[model samples]
Target: MAVNLQKGQKISLEKEAGGALSRVTMGLGWDVAKSGGFFGFGAKSQAVDLDASVVMFDESNRPVDVVWFRQLKSRDGSITHTGDNRTGAGDGDDEQIVVDLRTVPESVRSLVFTVNSFTGQNFSTVQNAFCRLFDTSNGKEIARYDLSVQGSHTAQIMAKLYRHNGEWKMHAIGENGSGRTFDDLMPLIVPHL
Candidate 1:
């Protein structure tokens, strides 16, 4: 079972499953909103090339690595992006980033998951946007953060997974922002890291 998390809510990964998770996946999904048409039959919905990105930060809150469409894997090879999904036409997990929890560098204390519209469309043009965390071993969903809030912002700081006292926890952020890529979201994400 998965918990629908509210903004600012936190949950310990180990406590949620009664054991430590060796592998986890952060999945992001969304859909293109349709423009008006007769009876909503042939309405044209613009194809949005929204991107899912993960930024790794050290204890000092400095960015250490990133995984996205361009850079599909972190330098250390612990984090890997499945691939780029240019269209939101899929059923589930339009983009996925797999993390080997045990292999992640000890220096990297936190991982921030983010989404941005690479084609300039804002969240108002998107629907059913979501970010979810899953335990890879059992394929069980642990938590979900829905980015269903419509707005003019082009980006979102979806969630963050960080280590505290040797335990891993996840936090839902769900903040609307304006950016086309990870680099552009750095300023808005810094304060949150």
Candidate 2:
């Protein structure tokens, strides 16, 4: 079953499985604010100073994995202060999260992805956020969740994996607040599990 996530919550993916997941993939997508106008008018704006990441934790909720940790750049080479569109404008800003679930400690139980303002003061708003979990054994999407804007500049989204009645389950969590770095996300993550 899929879990309903509120803004600013984290869900553990490996709670009662008795071991770590074999493989996991996570993806996030969002719309950037348009540029050249006072209210998203005129020219299309880019999210230049955006930072996205996915962190994995053990059953004990310890740090285990990190992915997509960097500042985004424009792929088309258009330098008008607009942000980079990696997959073209039509696809939106999409990032992937892949984790070798087998490598995660058996004590760990979940994974988290926190989006933030990377350029200090630029691109502080999160227009939209979505996440999907995939099973590596067969490259299948097991579950998905759409993040709701909680009026915060940053958000800590979580996905938990566990076994229920002989079937695996994923729970998604959406937490709000400004968490630009991994250290900032730790505090918000520990208590959620």
Candidate 3:
């Protein structure tokens, strides 16, 4: 049973999973919108190269590590990105970031998940976009955030997972920005940290 998360909503991962979570996964998915088609006729869908990234931050809100398409794993080997999906053509998750919760460094106080269009395509050309969290061991979905807000921004700071009283929790950020990569969006993401 997964909760459809609203923007700014927060949830306790431990309570949602019925116990401590050993490993978790953040899955990002989306689809390209079709254009130049008659009513219900043949329309050509544009290719959207969206990248999912996890930025690990310390108590001081300083980014300590990041796992993305280029950097597939964190320095400590606790987090790993599945791969990149150039075209959001298939169903389910287009990209996945797996986190071994137990192995995540104690110094890391928060993990921010983000998505950006590497090809500079804005959200207006994307549809059915979503970010979801689940237990990697059993594949039980815990929470899902719909990234369906269409706009001209090329990136979205989707959600955050932070430690609270020795437990992990989730917060849906749903902030939009104009950037083609994580480095370009760092300024916009710092305020949320």
Candidate 4:
């Protein structure tokens, strides 16, 4: 079952129902640049610095491992080195992060994504951020969340996983700011885990 997510929502997964074989996949998406321009026309283009990551945590919310991390660019969704921006500047663009839960420790109960920088001088205003969970067993989407509610800012976006009764649950959070490190994101996400 694919979880349909809206902005400012959260879900959790329970182990009692799915057992150890349960796997979850999370995806983040956003429009990097706007057609009108960055903060409007005649302004410096902002490039998404594109630092994406997934941190696995146990029930206790302790750091487990980094499941996936990358800096992305306009590559037609291909996983290759398109490039990186020291400053957040550019036209409208799309960037994403993909995480496969199977590779991480089974104890992991949640995942979080943080934007390190908008590198390009113009692209710093993030339009959207989101995460989704997929059922690896059937290759179906279990749940999804859209984080576009917090428009035009840099911050940490988080998704939580835990079991409620016998089903998995997830929670989506959008933290706003720039220069905030990944470590700063943990506290906002830990409560949901």
Candidate 5:
């Protein structure tokens, strides 16, 4: 069964399966809202070039690696980005990051998921935005967090997957921010990390 996560909610990766979640994938999806043009005329909805990324941080919160459009795979081969999605017109995941949890280096303690509008289109024009975690082995959705809240922000700090006392857990953040890329979101992300 899939769990709908509320902001700040944290859940174990193992669920009731009695075994560790060895491989998981984070999926992000969104669509641009059709806008009524000037003077109440219909204008074609613009495509939102939203990008999903993961930043790996060490124990002290120092960034160790990043998996994004430009860098599809982590140096150690634990994290891999499927590919870039120019348009969010698909039925399923528009962007996905797969992680071999057990293969992650011991030095890397946490992973942060972020989504940004590279075209600078604010969330107010985006609809049906969501982030989800799935067990790759079974293709079962483990947890999902809605990122479709109405706001003027251009990006969001979606969630965090981290190691806690020998177990992997996920925390829903759903915090909005103004950023076109991960670099622009660093300041806002620091306070939360």
Candidate 6:
């Protein structure tokens, strides 16, 4: 069974999945809100180019590597991105980042998942945005975070997966910010780590 996570909620992956997980995927999805054309004539939906990224951080909260649309994989090959989804069209996850947890370097302490509109479209133009984590071994969703807040911000610091006492855990971080890329999200992410 999948757990719906609230903002700031934390969960132990081991307990939620019934055991240890070797691989997991962070999936992000969203839809573009329709705009009422001149005098409500033609309501149309524009394509939203939202990019999902994962920033690997070390023990001191320093970024070790990042896997995003531009860089599809981490330096060590432990993390891989499923590519960018410019339209946010169709169903399910628009973008996905897969992590081989076992192969992640010991020096990398946390993985921060983030979503941003490379096209500069704010959240007000988006709808039904969400981030989810699932066990890759059995294709079971373990946790999901719905981004229900709509605003002028262009990006969001979605969630964090970190190691705690040799066990993996997840934290829901629904912080909104204005950014077109991962570099712009660095400051907003530091406080959460």
Clashing pairs in 5: none
TM, every model: 0.97, 0.61, 0.98, 0.59, 0.94, 0.96
Please give the clash total of every predicted structure, in order: 0, 22, 0, 45, 0, 0
Report the C-alpha lDDT of model 6 over 126-156, residue by residue, as the tens digit. Answer: 9999999999888899999998588989999
Better of 4 and 6 by lDDT: 6
What residue pairs clash in candidate 1, if any at all? none
- Against the true structure, what is every candidate's RMSD? 0.9, 8.5, 0.8, 7.1, 2.0, 1.5
* TM-score for candidate 2: 0.61
Q: In model 3, how many backbone clashes occur?
A: 0
Determine which window of 10 residues in candidate 2 has minimal summed lDDT.
73-82
Candidate 1 residue runs with Cα over 4 Å from true position: none
Model 4 agreement with the true structure over 65-107: per-residue lDDT tens digits: 6533343421222122223334333332233344443443445
Candidate 2 per-residue lDDT over residues 122-171, each given as its tens digit: 33334555666655456555556665353545545445554334434555
List residue ranges in candidate 2 displaced over 4 A.
1-22, 35-41, 64-93, 120-124, 136-139, 148-150, 162-168
Give residue 128's error in model 3 in angstroms: 0.4
Scanning candidate 5 in windows of ten residues, the lowest lDDT window is 13-22
**Best TM-score among the predictions, by candidate number:** 3
Local error of candidate 2 at residue 34 (angstroms): 1.8
Model 6 RMSD vs true structure: 1.5
lDDT of each: 0.92, 0.50, 0.94, 0.49, 0.90, 0.93
Q: After superposition, how far is residue 120 of candidate 5 from its true place, in Å?
A: 0.6
Ranking of models by TM-score? 3, 1, 6, 5, 2, 4
